[model samples]
Target: MLADLRLITVQEYHRMAEAGILDADERVELIDGYILKMAAKGTAHASAVTRTEQLLRQLLGNRALLRFQDPIRLNNYSEPEPDIAVVQIDPLDYADHHPTASEVYLVIEVADSSFQKGCGLKAKAYARSHIADYWVLDVAERKLHVFRSPSQDGYQTETVLREDATISPLQFPNAIAIIRDLLPKLRAE
Candidate 1:
């Protein structure tokens, strides 16, 4: 926590939206009680996200729910809208409430400019919330940053794989995803 800043809870975050302090279109989220503006999605990042989603959907089918750029409540102070959240299949499709950390199987972030935040602060929040599988697709660098073995401190294991590599989420071991497919014609910006 920073000494100079005041932190707001998730409840307050919602209230701000209702009070018009925050707009519905605002690209912001609550991370560790801090209201942080999310990075704008670039062409490469958007394409990567769509590709990853399609691949995961083909693999998962009716097994897991795939949420694209949707909110998942991590804690009292953290409710981030990850690029892709692979969660359990709820009968009501999570209409009752937002998916929580425990319901999440894998969290993926497609990043070009926000690569650091995806692998750093966001990764730490996911790890602390016991998200066993967290991946960051580095659109600019054309790499996959995989984080596993979560702890209160952070992820115990962190691996960066190249575009030629293959990866499988913790929940869906047999469903392999190729790194190259996740980033097609990616270029640094």
Candidate 2:
């Protein structure tokens, strides 16, 4: 016999958080109406995220709002907290709500243990939301996976850049980031 699983909406997810059902320290995101526990950040992953955050801030400056490890409301059933989100500058600083797909210029996820999910489910969700630019910093391989031209099925364009390569956001073409600069240097064994 098949079992039925109930899926919660984004609204319900928020309500659960507000109601103390989901603690503040709980690292979870609503994905496809399911609460997905985010992977614990390792030293390398944390370092990479910090480095990427710094680089993005330096390059974007006042041109965009850079949010780190914050929720971007994708749809009614999904609200994934990406590692770095390049958003439109809002005077109110998005006090009333999280950045939506339209407000977001780029979403970046720094992946160590979550590489598969980052490039698979996360990518699909972002693309389905019509997010134009999505990037996954693969910590294990030390590469940058860039996804663009979103369609309902998935991103139409996918590119992988090595450490020696550089990439710039489609919105801010002048501000470039070397792939290596945004990643954590592997320690010498």
Candidate 3:
């Protein structure tokens, strides 16, 4: 006999959180209707996230709202919490709901071990939603993977930036970020 699997929607995910079926301490995300546990953050991963957040804040200033380690509703079935998300300024403050794909300007994920998933499944999901820009900071490799031109198949453009390279977001062409500034400096033992 074949076993049946149940898929949960974004609404149900919120309800589960509100009803305490899911604890606030649990690091998990809904991807393709499955709740996947996020990997624990190592020192390098944590530092990179902090650095990226700081750099984006300084570059964007009041022009965009930067959300760190927060969930953005991708669609009816996915709400993956990105390391950083640049969203449009909303006067109402998104008080009623999370920013959807259209409101998002860019999404960044700091990947140590999650690099494969970030580039594969996560990239496909973001592309399906037509997210214009997606970036994956590969901590182990010390590089940045930039994805753009989203389509149903996936992002059409993929660019990998080394430590010495710099990148500017499509939304803010004038604001530039040195790729090295976003990665954590490893101290020699």
TM for candidate 1 is: 0.95
In model 2, the worst 10-residue window by lDDT is 1-10
What TM-score does each of the candidates earn? 0.95, 0.95, 0.94
TM-score of 3: 0.94
Cα distance off (Å), candidate 2, residue 129: 0.6
Model 2: per-residue Cα lDDT at residue 173:
98
Winner by lDDT between candidate 2 and candidate 1:
2
The per-residue C-alpha lDDT of model 3 at residue 48 equals 95
Q: For model 3, how many clashes?
A: 0
Worst window of 10 by summed lDDT in candidate 1: 180-189
Tens-digit lDDT string for candidate 2 (159-178) = 99999999999999999989
Candidate lDDT scores, in order, read 0.92, 0.92, 0.92
Model 1: per-residue Cα lDDT over 1-189, one tens digit each: 468887899999999999999998999999999898999988888889888888998988989999999899999999999999999989899999899999999999998899889988999999999999999998888899999999999999999999999999988899998899888563552
Candidate 3 wrongly placed segments (more than 4 Å): 1-4
